[model samples]
Target: MKILFALISTVLAGGVRYIFEVANGLKDKGHDVKIVALAGDHSWFKNLRAEVIYKPLNLNTFSSIVYAFYKFYRYVTLRSAKRNPYDTFLLISSKLGVRPDIIIELAELIRSFDSDVTVATYYLTAFSVWFSQNKNPFYLMQDFPELVEGNEGKLGLNMFYHSLKLPFSFITVSSYAKQLIVENNPTAKVTIAHPGVDLNIFRPRKANSQNQKYYGNIKGV
Candidate 1:
């Protein structure tokens, strides 16, 4: 099975680890997985076994005019590069080749790739792909911030919770959170992945007798 996973929380504390493990498990099952990411969220998983696709374009946040302007600038620059002309860069679903009709554009990019199952735990990250794609979408809902102070921009997260009201099979992180989702959406289905840590990399870090730095500033520090 080919799976497409898209999200913004890959920048969160446990986001990269969760994505990596999920992708790793899927690959172990002999499945092809495609991951779409914005910001620097996918850095840790770039070398992972599954195929990772990135658009390198960020969406706009209604934080302020400056942020909005920066998003526009980046979008236009990406368009000129002839990578995608959705009037914005397609982060995950350029294969869709159509404008994002949903709340967020990046979601559409991911879904456009024509994967069998698309999973998103973040709301707006799931919106675009499920909105445009004709494939089955699986959303893994873990965190929904009530208020984001200095966390990150309100680009995708806020949109998912507010603007998009799409149907999805939700996989919640906790039982309490699952009840909350059902209370909010009676028809929404919830499943838990019972998260765990990978023992392979969780072992103690052995210190080396000698240490080297990549740069002078790093070396001095």
Candidate 2:
């Protein structure tokens, strides 16, 4: 079966790793797999079985105008008002970097490919996929994705939480994550698909006598 995984980035994160692994595993089983990234470090695409498609999104004309005005407002506020720099950046960067229309364009692109199965790896991507009218696209939700601050941050988080109730089925990384989605929408279809670790990379090693003695002493203390 041909499969497509839609994601915003292939950065070095747990969710990104999981998507890569799943794509690789499926490819090994003789299924065609591809990854779609909006914008990310080009180096992150190296050594992947899935074909990486880099699709950079530009703001539409109206959005660009709005963004310019928003930036100007922010600049003026920063100069006149005393605000926490981190919070300010978080508030502005959350939705400004990628607007809803950009995600919609991305979804349209993915749908054009006509894969047998399209998977949305992020809530935003899921929105894109759903809006594209894909029938039963799998949503691989890895986290709650509350990586913002301030009133705008809570709004972003709420948007993500509500997206779980959409028609798309979900595959969560852990039971806890599945429970969270269920709590948001009891009728939501979610499954737990735990990630696997390579034992060779994380295998236990025998401790040296000195190391063992140090641990023993520490335990006693």
Candidate 3:
């Protein structure tokens, strides 16, 4: 099957890593898999097997020009920041009258693929997937994004909550997440798909005497 995973950004995060692992596994199983994101930065993880398409926000309008200037200001002020700036920039641009343009562009990009199944990895991308031409849309609900701490006053929290109620089949990693999705949207069709660990990388190993000795000295040990 031809599958496409839509993501907000390709940053270094556990959820992003899980998406890459799942996409790679699907590719290894002989399925055509691709990932589409707003920003690209995959240097942290190595040996990515699936293809990635990056379509950053680009609007040729007066508001977009102002947004670009704001981005430049943020870039200069938050140069020492570690998080991806595009994530917040996208949210802020929405209030600047560039959101519709972004949505149209993203939907057009998604339609160009014509994949059999299109999956939204994040709440922001879910909007694009819903509006795209793809008939089969699935949301990979890894967690309760709206309930996450530190996002209380941000626009993303409200958007995340609203995205859950959209008409789409949901796939989650845990039964707890499934319960949350059902509670939030009673009509949601959710399926649990637990993450798997690779035995080659996580198998048992013989204990080292020196390491044991060092750890044994601690009170907890």
On lDDT, the candidate that comes out on top is 3
Off by over 4 Å in 3: 61-102, 145-149, 152-154, 203-205, 210-221
lDDT of 3 by residue, 58-139 (tens): 6458756766676677679986434343565665655563344445566778888979999988776788899995989999
State the lDDT of candidate 1 residue by residue for 18-75, as single tens digits: 7677898889899988777654444555457876665544435532454455567766
RMSD of each: 10.1, 6.7, 4.5
Which has the higher TM-score value, candidate number 1 or candidate number 3? 3
Better of 1 and 2 by lDDT: 2
Where model 1 places Cα greater than 4 Å from the true spot, the runs are 9-12, 45-47, 58-103, 147-165, 200-221
Q: Estimate each model's TM-score.
A: 0.61, 0.77, 0.76
How many clashing pairs in candidate 3? Answer: 0
lDDT at position 157, candidate 1: 44
Rank order (by lDDT, best first): 3, 2, 1
TM-score between model 1 and native: 0.61
